[model samples]
Structures are given as structure tokens and as C-alpha cells.
Target: MAWSRDEIARRIASDIPDGWTVNIGVGIPTLVPRYIPQGREVVFHSENGILGMVPLREDESPDPEVIDAGKNAVSIRFGGSFFDSSVSFAMIRGGHIDLGIVGALQVSQNGDLSNWSTNERMIGGIGGAADVCSGVKQLWVAMMHTAENGTRKLLTDCTFPLTAVSVVCRVYSDLAVLERDERKWKVVTLSPGTDLLEVRNATGFPIDI
Candidate 1:
């Protein structure tokens, strides 16, 4: 069985440390704020120009004027600070963020990331990905383990354009929790009904489970 979305959220939440500033990229990374524990003093930064943002209400968009990196409408929470894009990049490049959660298209064995684009589909710009990957203390990549056709996304090497090389420290996918060891990716936790060999077979690499 594949890991549920809540399980993936918990795995990402477990890695967050108290009082650390975090920047979450678009997609599944947005879910991290929902599972943060109480009194942890976590400040979430948005490249769309907000810091210390609280999770927006799911029912209604609080402020049509306010939004996140993904351009999703949001509301400002008490104690949240707002800044322009230049200032946001400064914070990212200055190493003020402790951890970043990002979605990826492909990840190599050595932890290279390629989430910026899909060769066949021209979406939008790469945004602040390059800056965040290089500046954050640690990076957590979140995505499904396989493509829609069941092709492996985590591999011995990434074929998509590289976003950052050797920057990913951990991964949270629908199939398992993975960590990078030396030049190899290790399966730290397999999904229910998935054994060690099954993970290795799906990874298409020498994964240490």
C-alpha cells in the first residue's frame, strides 16, 4: 500500500526542529505548516513575500490581496511580517532559513534536485528555488515515488535539468522515507506492505534499506 497524505505530512513534521525558520516551496510542501506542534515557535516564510505566516483558513480566502509563492490566496496571522521579493531572496541567500521543504520532479542518488521544470511542459519560472536550495541549512524533498505510468522518479541519476546538486538531505514520498548516505540513497522507512527488496526494485539503484 502507498503511504497516505497524512502519513507523509507527519514524516515532514517530525523532521522540523523547534524555533527553526522554514521556507516551504509550492505543492505538497505547503502541508508542513498544518502538522507543526504547539509552542514550537516555527516561523514559515513565503517567497511571494510573507514571513511568520500562519496557515490560511481552508474555507475562505482571508485576504484577496495577500498570497503565497504559489499565488494562492491567504491571510496574515498575528506576528506575521511581510516583505518584498528582493528582501525575501536576501533572507534565503543570507542563510536565515533553517530548513526548506520542496517538491521535486527527480532526485539523483547523490541528492541532486530537478523540480524546476518538466521538459515537455513549460510551466512558469523557476522562482526562488536555486537560491533556497543553496542557502537553506537543510532541504526536505516531498513527492510521489513514481510517475503516473509507474516509472521511478528517484534514480541513480536525474535526467531532468538540475536545480541544485547534492543539496537534498531527506525525502518524503508516497512509498517511503528516504535519506542520502554518502553517494547512495537509503530507504529509512518502507510503506506498509512494501519490503526492502521492493523499495530497491522501484528505486532502480543500490538502495540500502
Candidate 2:
């Protein structure tokens, strides 16, 4: 079976080291915090200005005031702090964040990312993605391997407008986890019941197993 969205998030969370500050992008990335191992410290940063964001409890009511970059209601951890967008952007631009977990529309073989916009809805949507991708020490993408129509999103090059160039260090897709190794895409791990052949077929570029 392919890795479910929650499973992919869990995989990414398990890979994150303790005590690292992370920025979670929209989509599947929002699921990361719920899977973080207990006793581990992962400082989650939201572009809107929250530094200690947590997913709302299952039965817990959302605080209309507390939300994430996606504007979804979330709770805050005890040590969490809130700031204005200016300070938040400063933190992002200053590269204080250790890891940035983002969702992608496409990721090129060279690690180029195109996530903020597409030709269809091109007016606005360029949020802090550009700054986060460019400034973060490491950027990990969590997304589906292909579009709903089965088109590959892991391409030799991105067709959509670029968010930032060559910034994606790793990708956690429904099918597998691929990492940049020696300037080439390498299969780090495959989803349960997912084989190399399936991943190879799903990827748009050559991948080293």
C-alpha cells in the first residue's frame, strides 16, 4: 500500500532530529506535528507569527485566534510564542530555522521547487515560501508523487513558476522518500508495499536506488 498522508507526515517527523526549529508549509506538512515523537522538541514556526504551533486535539475546540500559515485553527504549545509578521519574516530571512517542511506542486531533479503559484491562479499566493525556501538550511517537501490524473510532480525540471531554485534537500512523497545525493536523486526509502519499479515509474527523472 502507498503511504497515506498521515503516514508520510509521520515518516518525515520521525526523521527530524530533536531540538530543531521547523517551518511547516501548507498541505501535508500541517500533519507533521501530530506525529512528532513525545519527549522530542521540534519548534514549529508559522509564517503568520506563531513559534509554537500544535494541531488541535481531536475533540478539542479550535481557538479562532490561534491559526497556522494555512489559516487553519491550531493550538499552541506551552513554550510557544507569537510575534508580528515582520519578526517572523526576519527569522525566516535570517536563516534561524533549521528545517523547513513544505508541500510542492513540483520538484525538479536539481531540487528546484515550484509551489507558490501556477499559471491558472497566478495573481497572488506568493506567501513566505520564497523566503523560507531560500533561507532555510534544509528544506524537506511532503507531497503526492503524482497529480490526481497521474502526472508526475517529480520532474527533470519544473514547468510552474519557481519558488526558489535548488533548495529542496529531501522529498517525502506518498510513494517514497528521495534525497539529493551527489547532485542526483537517490531513493532513500520506499513506502510499504511500494517497490523500486513503482517509484522509478512514478518519478520523471532518473533515480539512484
Q: Which candidate has the highest TM-score of all?
A: 2
All predictions: root-mean-square deviation over Cα?
A: 1.7, 1.5
**N/CA/C clash count, model 2:** 0
| Estimated TM-score for each candidate | 0.92, 0.95
* Candidate 2 lDDT by residue in tens digits, 1-209: 89999999999999999999999998899999999999999999999999988888889898888989888999888999999999999999898999999999999998999997776876358888999999888999999999999999999999999999999999999999999954698889998899999999999999988
Cand. 1 Cα-lDDT: 0.84
The CA lDDT of each predicted structure is 0.84, 0.92
Point to the candidate with the largest lDDT: 2
Question: Weakest 10 consecutive residues, lDDT, candidate 1?
Answer: 117-126
**What is candidate 1's lDDT per residue for 119-154, written digit by digit as tens?**
876456678898999889899998988888988888
